[model samples]
Target: MKIIAGVIIVISCSAMLKKDDVVRQAFDHAAKQTLVMLKEVAIKLQAAKAESKNPMPVAPRTLKDGDLVVVPSRDWTSGFFSGVLWYLYEYTGKKEWLDEAKKFTAAMEQEKWNGKTHDMGFKMYCSYGNGYRLTKDATYNDVLVQSAKTLSTRFRPITGVLRSWDHSRDKWSYPVIIDNMMNLELLFFATRSTGDSSFYKIAVSHAKTTMKNHYRADNSSYHVIEYDTLTGKVLKKNTHQGYAHESAWSRGQAWGLYGFTMCYRETKDKAFLEQAEKIAKYIFSHPHMPADLIPYWDYDAPGIPNEPRDVSAAAVIASGLYELSLYSPNAKDYRAKANTIVQNLSKNYASPVGGSKGFILLHSTGSKPANSEVDVPLSYADYYFLEALLRKDKLEKTSYKSIQ
Candidate 1:
């Protein structure tokens, strides 16, 4: 009861926000409130780990190998966990948090990632990047190299993009997802870090494939597409995230925004920059976007209570916005919007590190196919929350006020 009261009070602080102001100040205040409850948050992670009798995927989901390692109760935990550690380390220059982050980094190596999953970018690279930056562990470098090798193996020459899904149907390779665009950043990073050009070439080709097919006339993206790998043609563009064939999913749009910005960062391609700006502009100006930083799972989705919001997507975009801000030649407004999302999420949506609750965001959607936790805490939600925090902390430290 007391905890609920505290949460309510903390949430009330969110109301201090106004439209024009960048949200860093409000977010910092909320984070300070969370620090008051940080010990409880750490304890929750331990308790959840110890009291666990039900094995992996918590209780709701079945035992899939991918879900066991490198997952929050939902997918996308690393982006949050590593993001938080990165944020803390950046702020305090502490060694303890850095040490704790090392374990997760090491644990990811055991997972079965041969680049068959779109999430490889979200999982291995995110944690490995943390490991490389934090401890400079030579082992981490080796693990990253292996994961890159595996990820590259998924590159379908016929499709000119990495394949995503391998299940139930003899591992069909035609379907490409919009989320794959975000994953290509790993290739660019791997190439630059390893002085290998193959990685860069693959990343560029993948981006081009997405640009040509996955998007609609309005610059919105489709969640999935069935491609003709042999002929390098798109067979069908379906709506895994949307309501119908052409409806746009807001989170997918956010992925497009963040992903294209990342594409531009790696390739310096003018096309990617323009596409990112288009997506960001649509997302920011759209009437359906909630007053809060979070967005509905689909833009045209009916406002039923069952509809899910993608806080993880928002976090991803915020991090991308920060990068876009840095990379954009004359794009001040995009940076400001990015800064705004970070500030707003930190101020309103993020849950403090209280009572062993590793989740940073309050609302996230996951695996609608399983009728899973609809509007609940998710691993990726937590990941993006942490990522947003890291971006905010870095911006603050650099004295780089967000451009308005």
Candidate 2:
């Protein structure tokens, strides 16, 4: 199934098929390519994680796997390093990466005081999911459970949005960011883990609020929509992820698609399926979409007219599409779309030049604030890329247990 290595042969054979049939075949081919890339990327990343002596990268400073420290004065995602190893485990089913990811699971507690942002998904799931899947270690489970409990405590009944903190001059507020949707998967998992439905209820309620208030009529999504701290009403829908009001941020859209798909997977809700598909179509049909399926930072974005694309967004959407396909009326179309994205990402962005010994995908974005970390490398990009690969691999009936 190392499909990209023989894509030319596939293209030649594909000419005989009908348009719909061709799309299905193309996606199937791409899914295979993604698998090959995941296997290769994870193998190299595992080596980097092992070679790390202190689990922190040295100054002169470039990012590497298992490195405890990452770019300072940057987004929280950069520092959450071991999560990549966990992705490797999930994608490749390799035990060594899981063992490595476990080492960093406990650090999130100590780092919790690093000041929470709208990225609890990065903080909690990277370790919690890895730990649960790897050792079935209840210590990791306990940490995740406690972290989620801590997170759930922040949910505001008034606003129906979780509070995110970034203290400035002794102030913090219920800054509702779209990325919070990704963290809802934790709530669904917590319900199963603890037999408590309260977490699930809160998550669902928040998602409903977000759906009603945040999305534009055109289906483009806003990044931040501030809730009235005192009144629990929608104060404003702003664009923190994009340039102006009502702008469509690509990653935010990706989050909605991925998040809603996860919700549907857990609850079997048709509404979530519809919402996920709506966002997916917006992303797919956007005029700014490049020949390669990955997107520029935002559809109506400026600055770099051809600004670097985010592989993380593409990977997340592809993963969501795979899930969406499972429940679609035209299952083949959804799956083909998912597969094409996986293939494009695998062949174009994935390092066909062969391992850098560290980086997996070529392009990923971080905070747009202060123009810091624009189109730079990212850990979550690597993590979700692995996830898309694994999700596709699982559907193929391949034995993931071999890596373990």
Candidate 3:
């Protein structure tokens, strides 16, 4: 019996080693494909800047037909490509990636004071936030602090949540979308950097308010929750991107999961951690989630097998799970689920190595109901996919308790 037990232990250890090797290989492949695609993107963007009268391209958004669609710095998605470049720099420690990251990140500096929208974090933090983390440049610090202050302007004291849109007034009195949860990280960063507890307080208020209102009985999240600015009353629940008001939007759910996990990380709040875990359960245990762990644009979308898969959602969920694993008692399960997502994305969803205009992953649905950016390779998808890979690598080297 003792001899048999020893043999089983050896086999288990060998299997674990082999699994680690597979993950390492996946990382290597992703790094190679990313470098190849981004080099082409840089060349094309430079040529376009020289010929066009438009503002400088800050990031690649998606593919229109087969061509690259680059956005100016003011675009909400402008920071993701820069964030990707920073991830590449971190992974390869190459000066070329560092240079490209700095150039792209610099273009987003003008948005530090642009309070017209609530995407300050998506527009600035993803770029400059990651830049500061990697390089510690003092200028990046100023950009981030100012960006947080600008984002704070959208917070409605009565509503206890940041207003998500300024242009959709005709549709909602005070619109707050699940995507806004992602912006709270910038606020938390500001509090840490400046020692201004106001940022922290606002972030906590938003998180708590959303937790109370956004979730349904099954822990599924609504895409949009409209509020009455005068009374702090819940007006209505709506869906701008999902199939229906009550249906769970895949990416929105992903945002909620990532956001709460991040909140827990910053605050060590057990309620936030519990909320994140519940969201994770809702995602993985959904009847419509595909075998690959990628989900349809909406969990309740009518066509399940035929609907477009949102790789972007999968990327965000994978990244969030990696962080949640570090904090939750169910660390092993979360890690396994995240690994499955990374493996499937690296294997089945990637763009052709030298193709897709340099975007890394494919088949990301961006607001399908609007018939916009459907079945495309999105920049944010690539950003979170790279982030998930880095987080997975860290988990392999360190224990769960060692991370935080």
Candidate 4:
């Protein structure tokens, strides 16, 4: 009897160890592939810089048809590669990654004064913001404050929201997209850096207005909300990238989830926390969410298993849920969901050693409506995936309260 009991105990112990070993292997695979992708991009960036006296500063954007898609520094996604480099440095404590990160970040310095669009946060904060956070560079702080000022120029106090674009006037007057929620972090950071309350006020007002108008009854958000600039009335609710005018885009949902989770972190606002929980419920309860936890481009898109999955959306959701899990009442559930997403992405969506043309996550649909960038690997997807892993690693090494 004693011998039989010992055998059973050993079997159970071995099974647990095997499960832990697989998890560790998945994380190490993700990190090593990311390093390869960064080295591949650095070579291209150096070549692009050598070709012209005043280069546009090309960097990786996505992989389409097994080829790399590089974009100019002014592109909205340009900051993400730099951000990913910084995260790599943070993870490996490697000086080479830090050197490359500074080079990419310096190439994007001109975006601090770019006021033509609402993506300044995506343009500056992700790169310079992370740079500043990690290094405490005074120069990066100056650029971030100026970037916040430029981003503020688009704020329409009458509408209590930041105008997203000036060119889409033919369709709407003053448009505010749900993705703008992600940019508020730049504003909040600026206030803290400069001791200016105006930036904080604008950010809070934008969050409140978005909460009031952007969300539908089901807590899923519309892609775009047009408002009367003069009268502050909602002009229209439309979908620019989703399957239909009323469908919920997968990335849009992830943006809302990440934005409010971040908002609660910055302000300790219970309302924002509750909103994030509701969004999580909507996503988890939706039938369209795949069994593996990756979602299609749009939840309401016609094809079920036939639809292309958006790994970028999954990456963003997992990153946000990791932070959200630290503060929510459903902490364990949120953490488990985030782990499932990370596991699925690492196992299925991740590119093998030399498969992704130096990009990481696969099958990220950019805009199905516009017939653009479908089933590709995006740079931002790689950024958020690394971020989720780093966050999880930090949580494991130290308690959540000791993170800061």
Highest TM-score, which number? 3
* Candidate 2 residue lDDT tens string, 158-218: 8887765554313224567788888887777788899999988988988888888778887
Model 3 CA RMSD to the hidden true structure, in angstroms: 2.3
**How would you encode candidate 1's per-residue C-alpha lDDT over 143-230 as one tens digit per residue?**
7766676788888788898887675244335677888886786777778778989988988998988988888877888888887867
Ranking of all candidate structures by their lDDT, best first: 3, 4, 2, 1
Could you tell me the lDDT of residue 210 within candidate 1? Answer: 90
**Ranking of all candidate structures by their TM-score, best first:** 3, 4, 1, 2
TM-scores of the candidates in the order shown:
0.79, 0.77, 0.94, 0.92
Clash number for candidate 2:
1
Alpha-carbon lDDT, every model: 0.64, 0.65, 0.90, 0.86
**Model 4 TM-score relative to the real fold:** 0.92
User: Which stretches of candidate 1 lie above 4 Å from their native place?
Assistant: 1-80, 112-115, 168-173, 304-307, 352-356, 367-370, 396-404
Give the root-mean-square deviation of each candidate in angstroms: 8.3, 7.7, 2.3, 2.9
* Residue 243, model 4, lDDT: 93
lDDT at residue 120 of model 4 (Cα atoms): 87
Superior candidate under TM-score, 1 versus 3: 3
